[model samples]
Target: MAGGRLSWAGLLKWSLSYVDGAGPSGAVSEEERRWLAEAVERHMMVDVVSRMREIALLMSTPPAVLEAQGITHDDIEDLLSELQVHVESIDMANDLHSVGGLVPVIKYLRNSNARIRAKAADVVTTVVQNNPTSQQLVMEASGFEPLLSNFRSDPDLTARIKALGALSSLIRNNKPGVSAFRLANGYTGLRDALNSESARFQRKALSLTHYLLSESHSDCSVFAQLGFPHLMMRLASSDDSGVREAALGGLLELARDTTLGNRSLLAEHDRLRRLLRGRMESIRTMTPEDLDAAREERQLVDSLWITCYHEPSMLRNEGLLVLPGEESFEQPPDVAGRFFEPMRRAAARRAPPVEGSDPGDGTGGGIVLLLGLAPDGRSNSPSH
Candidate 1:
């Protein structure tokens, strides 16, 4: 247990000898868990890793510099706390790099300690954020099942929130990979989070639900079978701004899915349509406060519109329709001024349509004229 660098070979020798002596007795008082964690992690053997993991769990002491002897319970606990953060940061970086060795990281995601569990989830999410390869490994490692199981009963708000966040991150990609079929079971986790008492949990669950509906080409029947639509509706009244935003956003995304769109998702189509129509209708009948709300609503609607229909012509045409008029004296010139230049650029690129050419023939020349056309087919020009 001297301060010499601990190698896997050396660790194996020490571990075997320690096991023979009935578990490193007499308190190698100076052995730090971090150093032990590092050594065991490097060994990568199931036995060594398992033993170190157990030791880590046992030694939950605060930080103290370990000598050659062994560490205290408080020292172990402190080291573990920092280890969780360090592992999370490293796992996230590995995710960024598409490294394939994240299974151990996922193993600790549901640790008994809520903070540790949360960090584990964060690390899993980091792996999924960009590294599809590692994501697959994690899924095959049965990470999601235990995670979902924890969701059913875990009382820690932070742990539940992290679990939800991790699920969201994983379902963001639905392509063929190790994760391709993992989402088949994702509905369980999503439903649990959606039902949680925490607003943050609901928001994260909804966000993940939205992603699953949109990204994973899975059948919407799973959600429908789980009564997800009802769950979403219930959350629409969340008092938290983030929760409300996510609930609405999730529903919006769900509504865009052709599979769900035709089903019950938009069964409240009339309500949603009326909601949208009312925004326009009430603009003419709005009070000052209503006008301000309408303006902000319009900006949100415009941003959503631009995001969905990103083509320049579509943007220019829609931009003009949504831009506030002088009659709407509350219009913000600064906002319109920012929007005008983009509209003009889009209009300039738009070519006037050729009489009979295929629109797909790279001849989007009608863009400018399309931009100029009034919503009512009347000219944008001043009356003579």
Candidate 2:
């Protein structure tokens, strides 16, 4: 081996010569061939490492330094685009956070360039998803307002979808973040997303709406006024199964609201009843795999049924039995049943008694009296 710099071209030439019988009238010795192969491998590794080092240095450069270099927004957009490729690496994500890479990334969310804004929103979503610390930092950097603004008014559908996605990740399981979002009229943005022509945006918006509604009764109350329940009921029947599932999830959360008014409002909607009955019929006919896939939808349909019918027996059937102490003080019993019982009794009275039975036997034909009962094991109705 020569003590000279080894170029890839030179290695190739040597290897080709060795194969062409330039050495020893046919072929190089085994030792010589091994040495050439090792040399080529080592040179390739060195070149790769050198290129990697350049990339590392470039990524580690601060945003301020890039700005000082007169880097255009397009250049920053390219850099962020590259950064997004490695965002799945936890180490790279944390490094980006620690080095303040996210600050400029967040700022780019408001950039005049729509592509830049869209890419920035995607980067923010990837960084903050399931990462609470990054979420808080984004919030501190005023990241949320831009996302909500984009969601509300961005002309580009893709950018608005990205913004909605980021907002969903930003507030997931973050209490204060959700509160801040609610304070920013975030529900209105979400409502618009729900109404978007893009089904992806509607699906993501429904998921976030479910989370926010589950977090507080006040959010449920506000969203209810925005017709969130009606939107969900419509979406629950979406042609896209994912959209239907997300919408059903939102309806389930709304159904769980302890507020009597909210429950009543949902239960009283004729559309909701039709939706529930249709879904229940479909669930009954589903195959086992389909049943598993639709387990959440089935649960929600059942919940809505119980809510609408005020059937504690149905709740018990579903293992959602409410214990005595666990019941809300403000929740009244099934007063709808009580309110309709008199009508039922009046109708029963108009019908003739069974031919072989006495009317005084406390029975109208085979119909049993639904009279209120006393704790002493006696009916409150007048004795026969």
Candidate 3:
């Protein structure tokens, strides 16, 4: 009978192994991480609200054992962060079946101390990055707009850092639905960060600019109007490669449209014309709206092509041959053929493509190339 009882306890312990497993991969195994995500989801359905509360209590508790079997307080912190992410993912997954009580759980998310708050920000980020619908749900459940005030105005540096992190997450994740105040905050915060003494702050600011430029291609025109050209020139030549790359990428996004592309920003347009002929011929005919909708998709495809085509050794190894589209070897071919599926899938569901639409109808099917020269006078490829 004692053996039987011990066997039952062992089974329970085995089943609960996942409770302590989810963490940074450099700290835990891939299988453990996957199992933890699944187990956390299962446990959420069992007694999710209470389980989270129990974790909160445990987070405040001391560790009694350092044995191999039981979890430590540090482990709890890591696992709590992971569970927080899982809970947010569940909330964001748009499953109507989650317990209604999950409403309070999200409210609880914004309650932790600075370190925990940063962890919460990361959880919010995962939701925002992966699922838009969840972002709306999180906004509704947590009054995340008001939470922004705490993150921004907190006197503590830790609090401020957490808030900045959260703001970046919010900015990146909530695109079409972001409020005007959020945009205003981003403009203010990013502008200030640009002037910050700390290089870390400056890097984050650059990243924010990249995210904004890449996702909100519509706003590129405003940048030029606001003298972003000078700012971008400085950034492109910054000591930091990341900053330079981001500035270049943002400029690329902006120059896709006629209003921006036709400007002096694209001084290397002739080189781009030669390199990107077939690749971006469709972009020449794009309406401004089409350019906006397809900017991110095009960036991804362009990155892939650059990776494949730029390295001669890789090209030969892959047995890939480049066929010039014209006798003059003028432009790249309609590489759009390679990108057709991704474009078709990315076509906005609510915004139907117009009938008999041209390449730039913003409905779909085209590529835009933006070319700029480096200060050294070395020309970049169309893919760049």
Candidate 4:
């Protein structure tokens, strides 16, 4: 096993034994554990790279050649699905893009076959998500127009969902893509999705709207003009916790907008004020178990209420009463701290070494690491 191919069945047996305190000579050494870890990683990487190569070849092949080979559209859809599975890795996404795979994938967004279009959207979504280079490439390829068209007019709900997801991935943290999306009237489709009867569609739409507003002030303004704030306020009280959370998140983003117009619009919504006050009162009366179960919603609503309080003129305009020195909201007592405090203290029992002393070697002088932290927490240095 050490020098040859590793089988999943063999690995599973070894892992079970290791967990059950059964190893070679009845004990597992650190060397054995490290070797197992490395073997598992190598095995996984080999499988992934092999599959990625196949998909890339298929993507780059000419359509006529594929036809001559008896590869139908269904086969291509299956390959695209496989590509989607692998594209969660940044290297796979980059490889796909480098092999001229992206253009055909974007063209498939308008494929007559619904399954192919959905799979293509899934592939695009997986490729562009959290990947800035892929996002920029998709935007430069004019990918937004097809995606928006499908998002607006696709008869298949599943395809529409995938298209909306792909659009979200394209616009996330990409300003140029957002501008293109807005110019193409993408917001109208999003608004329709938000108002749809399907909670799943509404949730995805709200999540995308949250990302849009969070990235671009112009998007927030456009959404506000489309009465997104009112829609969010209505959804904030939704029976579906997920929907409520998404709506509140969007509302919170809108409230935090630095532009006075966005803030003022939220402030002037009478329904929003009433919703905030009503949720606050309900939360104040809830039992501990209920609060614990609804902790995320409670936190979001609390944050929204506090935001309202911070905006003074907005509150005053609503004729909401407030007392001086009453702006602070008390946090719930940290009940879990009583159980964890001793563990934390035990972990911190060792005193800190002198500032100039190296903990690694007991050498004098601290190390000055010149590392620039990027948004993703990766080092920004060229060597990185």
The best candidate by lDDT is 4
lDDT of 4 by residue, 1-384 (tens): 213334654785677587557864546677776777777777776666666666767766878898899999989998898778777889778777676678888888887889999999999999999999888888888788888888998999989998998988888788788778778888888889988887888899999888887777667777888989888888888878789889999999998886757766776778888988776666667666665565667667767766766744333343222223334234668898887787677656756767876677735332334457989998866573
Top candidate on TM-score is 4
What is the lDDT for 28 in model 3?
56
Clashing pairs in 2: none
* lDDT sort, best first: 4, 2, 1, 3
Worst 10 residues of 3 by lDDT: 320-329
Model 1 Cα lDDT, one tens digit per residue, 263-335: 3445444554444344345445656555554454444333433333333323234443344542442345787
Candidate 3 global lDDT: 0.50
After superposing candidate 1, which stretches have Cα over 4 Å from the reference? 1-92, 95-104, 174-184, 258-384
Give each model a TM-score.
0.50, 0.61, 0.47, 0.66
**Cα lDDT over the full model 4:** 0.78
Expressed as tens digits, the lDDT of each residue in 1-384 for candidate 3 is 335434555554655564455322245566875776576555545454545445545443433432344764356447546555445644533542143323433443455445545555555555555566665666666546544654455554555555566566655556543454346554555555555454565566667666766666666666566555455545544566455456556555555545556334444445433333333444345566654543543443254234323433322233222222312212667786776767565554436445687767434544443346768887655552
For lDDT, candidate 1 versus 3, the one ahead is 1
Off by over 4 Å in 3: 1-50, 53-82, 88-113, 150-161, 171-176, 181-185, 198-200, 225-228, 260-262, 265-384
Clashes of each: 22, 0, 9, 0
